[model samples]
Target chain A: MIDRTGLMVILSSPSGAGKSTLARRLMEWDAGLRFSVSATTRAPRPGEVDGVDYHFTSRAGFEQMVADGQMLEHAEVFGNLYGSPRGPVEQAMLAGRDTLFDVDWQGGQQIRASALGRHVVSIFVLPPSLPELERRLRGRGQDSDAVIAGRMEKSRSEISHWAEYDYVLVNDDLDETEARMRAILTAERLRRDRQSGLGGFVRALMAEEA
Target chain B: MIDRTGLMVILSSPSGAGKSTLARRLMEWDAGLRFSVSATTRAPRPGEVDGVDYHFTSRAGFEQMVADGQMLEHAEVFGNLYGSPRGPVEQAMLAGRDTLFDVDWQGGQQIRASALGRHVVSIFVLPPSLPELERRLRGRGQDSDAVIAGRMEKSRSEISHWAEYDYVLVNDDLDETEARMRAILTAERLRRDRQSGLGGFVRALMAEEA
Candidate 1:
């Protein structure tokens, strides 16, 4: 019921962690929340929509957007370019609609250091244990042993940065993690500095008996 | 579920502003939460239970507790002394249980400045409007005009201190306010510094494949 500025919820976790699943659950729980869609240089394989799954653009277009400061953050991953568009984020905040980001620690840090960084609430999610994380990764039944090992090494590097986050959660159980994330969103929305309507609300309260 | 250090959730509001009701609801919402019961010099009237409604004590005993630093904070109201005992609060935090405080701004400031200040999260509740506040006070059908006027003045003083709190919520809707409070607690619990167990959790993860 509060009229407030939207928050940028940055969720970072290593591959095989449940950050993506948790993010999906949170968005489903609150349909009003928007997921940040990154612009990618990779060609769509099949069912990926242009603006929904990603903003597919030519390499030249992606480079130009980055040069023009349109991208909040951009990077070259395995020869493909990908980055979040800054326009939608800024517009969402102005409209009091929160946007969620599923990014690694590098992207999380970049957005938090941006001009709109004050709006960011970064959370790091960890698996219950390394064995559990590997079990889940193997459960996918697609990645070979070599791929799983490389992913596990990458997870160690990512997990080392957990201390950098404002809040950290161990995703032992998906439902519990989802509940905590919802609570965090609920609390962040009520922060006094985020509620733009508070000044008028207080003014009216004072004028009531005047 | 998270295992972490307990926090001091201080809720302060003006007379007729609905803080007490909110505090009651919050305690009921989480049975594990401990209420910081105040020690009073006044006699227990009606159904008031000692050690629950209050810690009944003689004026001398209460004064001695304050002098000995046993009282977290104390105040003299209408020739009677009332204060929160520090022992139980300290014990509660060490046991990893949250403690809730229903205090005025003075008590809030005191608790926040105490040695355990880092553990406190103060929230101030604001009335929707003075007219609505006055209407509620009148609807209670107990107080006289002179009493109501005095309360309104006291409320203004209370409202003036809203800026001192970590959070300021307008109590226009009860359920919304409660939900927000729960969210704050959840997020605070996940603060990396609060969860002392996280270090061991992460260590276990690292040792999984080693």
Candidate 2:
């Protein structure tokens, strides 16, 4: 029998590097993968589902999870608490489901710290260049000039952490980028160290031979 | 335009891990990849082509290439000198052609020591178990009992170096094994550090928007 070990893929990138776009595309391609819905204190938008989009909780509830070690990683972002719940992710992984996280560098670090022994593979998406990153930000047209400037400034700091990732992909072309990200996840899933059932599978093959 | 960077993939496995089978399948699936023919001191076998099958070189010539830093990595195996030449590999990579190397753990180490940086991704394949490995060797019907025993013994040492590889695959099922190997190659190709042309491409998109 094949070993069905779970994989955790954390995708991080600057705002316009298309991390979210790639993440959505990956979910479409791989049915075994499920998005890790974050728990946040912020109120959900009109169209967002409470459990599906995010686990919306109040400050008290969020604090309780943190205290009980139910939150894998929690952070106060923009004065609202945002976190990943340990319960659902652990449950999914135990049942052999790969989880995908669209998180920032800070969140990635937090996840790493909390889930040290878990099969986690982190990838950093980079824009091809500083000029390209700035261009992507400007092209979005939704942000004001000041906001774009702030993002570009933050991008430098974020990109500096590229080396921290297990894999780094530059989002030059969406199709190619998506293909590459999918490949990384696929390769990592087959890693022997991550596949706990491999030993038993080998023993079974040996038994048949004997 | 996509910067077509060539990738060199080195796959090493103990006998019966199905390295050759996997290599053949990969070649059939991807047209862009070509096998790296080694320069050997030994004479060519029946149907081998001089330049195509191997760069069949004399011992002196092979040694010369080694001394001149022309060979990427070389070793004396079973009374014959075998080495991967640097020139053809570099040319192929520059021309956007991927190369595959069927080498052992020693060769893998040599390539890593050279630090080609981003151009090389190495994978090691393992059979599910020692008994399975022995069974596969015996089932091949190509070796004597003594030879099979030697291979099984050697495999223990070979597998001990599994930590050196970027990825490891257990060959339990042929189809899944092939798919997993291909996935690693594809993913490594998309790595941001390796794809220098990505910066230019993304910049061009930004320029267009501007």
Candidate 3:
């Protein structure tokens, strides 16, 4: 196999577009792929593991990490600070393990503009149709009409940034989208710049007399 | 399904590295893929068909085409003029069909610097090792020792340009290399810039009231 450096795969989409499902499928497909855990100031929900789900941190700790440039990307939502700690991601990349980031457009953009942007391969997922997206949202049977409407509004705004991604996939079928994501990962790993051992291999080949 | 523009896939390798075999396999795998036939001033050998195996032309005709900017890339090899005709390639791309180029490093560089260079995805193929490449070259049984030695020299020169390509594959296993090429093609097709109908598709999705 080819020896390569790790890649940063950013999967961004609105809720109900199957972005999370696709990300999960990718992680299941490649055992070496690592999920980037976000640091959050919000209290953990019942039964949710602290580091497994999110790195639950105090607001002061999160703000300090952000101010110290330890956060790759940070955003304040509903008065709670959420940010991706840069330490683990960098460590994973240096160890040649690809890290997956499930984030919104703002976070995707911020990560792509970060210092390690060149390693990022950003993808945006879109629903097959707006009605299908709304139907999926309603199928949850938990959100009220007002909540669904607000979510739909947010989804529309997020979809507007689809063109900013390096690759865009319409999640018409979960299986097909998952396959496409795998193909993207495979191809990006083969990129010339990512093949770290290729130069030495080629040098040895040249040294050998035919 | 996604509606996308075409791509130019350049496959380059030293002779005896299985580039031609891989290109043929790719064509067999994708019926829609087109192979670029080069125009040459050399006389056709037995069973060689013009416009298929090669576009046989006079030296004056080849120079005229080159001067008129009809040739995408051309070089003089073994006292014969050889060039890739731009017309068919452009037409294939306009029709949304991918075109494959079987050329060496110089030709690859020229095509990469051409006007349609943005559409090119160049790949370099390397043999598993230098001794393997020599073994394959000698296995042909069509050349004497001196001819094989000269070819080995040329192969080394060609392999030196491997870094110039977008992707490099060590052809240790043909099936695996072909699969990697397919993955690269699949992922590249989903690139945001290549999806020509994406803008209209996104507009319709936004227009639909959720």
Candidate 4:
């Protein structure tokens, strides 16, 4: 029986749908989950560490890795290149680890194309309502009216692709949303098709009959 | 804001995958869920009430309902006609209730064909191992070896159609499995696309901006 297999979970949402919050809560709840740290060309923010927050890489290094197909999926967002590295995620999976990806619908599609196994599950998070989303964005107190308006417009486009996800969650309440997210991770981990040792486990039981 | 919208959920599994157990637990846990009581031609067992356990009907009555397309779907199993009625389920939906169907793959397929909406979610349950399934079947002690063998064969056929489900749960442990099932139900209820008031909710917020 194969003992180790990896799961890649891609979580997509509009800016205020609580994707990041859910991811953080899941990591805290599940010790087996590891975040898929992307290699990015953007400069790290204060207190962000390379290989922790992100794998800070130069443009040439990023392009070389992309050319070598070391990255599972890569994209140019906001003029900066960001990509998921294949080697690390594969290593984690082989060690029976789950990886979480905080990405958009496009990135989720790329991962699905590259990894077509039972190990991948994609989820989309949505706000309870467009009005509530606007309220949440305004409550953040970080963006101007124009910035919030721009984000709202982008949210509509992002939400239009809701049907693309394996599971869709409406973030109406924080605690309840976190609980639902945890349940998906737990269920996905127990999928028989992804559990490598299942065939052997069955064989062992059937041996008694023989 | 639309206050009443109904969702139809189908839970199917190979025998010993705990579909009935999970469905029972979900009904006890969630008040919003209403089990779809199917109409059947078979006479009710001792103490079984019509309309509660089932809507007992004569063969002629069943045939008439089918001819009128009043049944959402119907099938014959063990010389008994069984079908889900369309009117009551739609009424529940209009009154803001979610209906659960403990059905086989065929019934699920028919529901998908008839009700492919944001409110519909289907899940397939799987046993963690074939050996476990065999053990569970044998442990029941009611089936002969021949009957057990027949069930095992049928299970393999059922499992082959796992890909047809939107979500798959491996029933390894009862509590975990029940929790996962509940999570799916809860999450589906909150999906923005399924929730009716979202459009008006958004409009209200946009109006405030003016």
The model with the greatest lDDT is 3
RMSD of 2: 4.6
Task: DockQ for every model, please.
Answer: 0.69, 0.33, 0.86, 0.20
lDDT of 4 by residue, A77-189 (tens): 89999999989888898898889999888888888888543577888887877777888889899999999999998888887777777777667888977887777776566
Interface RMSD of each: 1.6, 4.9, 0.8, 5.1
Q: All predictions: root-mean-square deviation over Cα?
A: 1.8, 4.6, 1.2, 4.8
Could you give the CAPRI-style class of model 2? Answer: acceptable
- Fnat per model, in the order shown: 0.76, 0.48, 0.87, 0.17
Q: What lDDT is reached at residue B58 by model 2?
A: 90
Which prediction has more favorable DockQ, 1 or 2? 1
Judge the docking of candidate 4 as incorrect, acceptable, medium or high. incorrect
Candidate 1 lDDT for residue B141 = 99
Ranked by lDDT from best down, the candidates are 3, 1, 2, 4
Error of 4 at A184 (Å): 3.4
lDDT of 1 by residue, A19-138 (tens): 878988999999989999999999997999999999999999999999999998888899999899999998999899999999988898889899999999989999878888888899
Q: What is the Cα-based lDDT of residue B62 in candidate 4?
A: 98
Q: How well does candidate 1 score on lDDT at residue B16?
A: 78
Clashing pairs in 4: A6-A93
Question: Measured by TM-score, how close is model 1 to the native structure?
Answer: 0.95
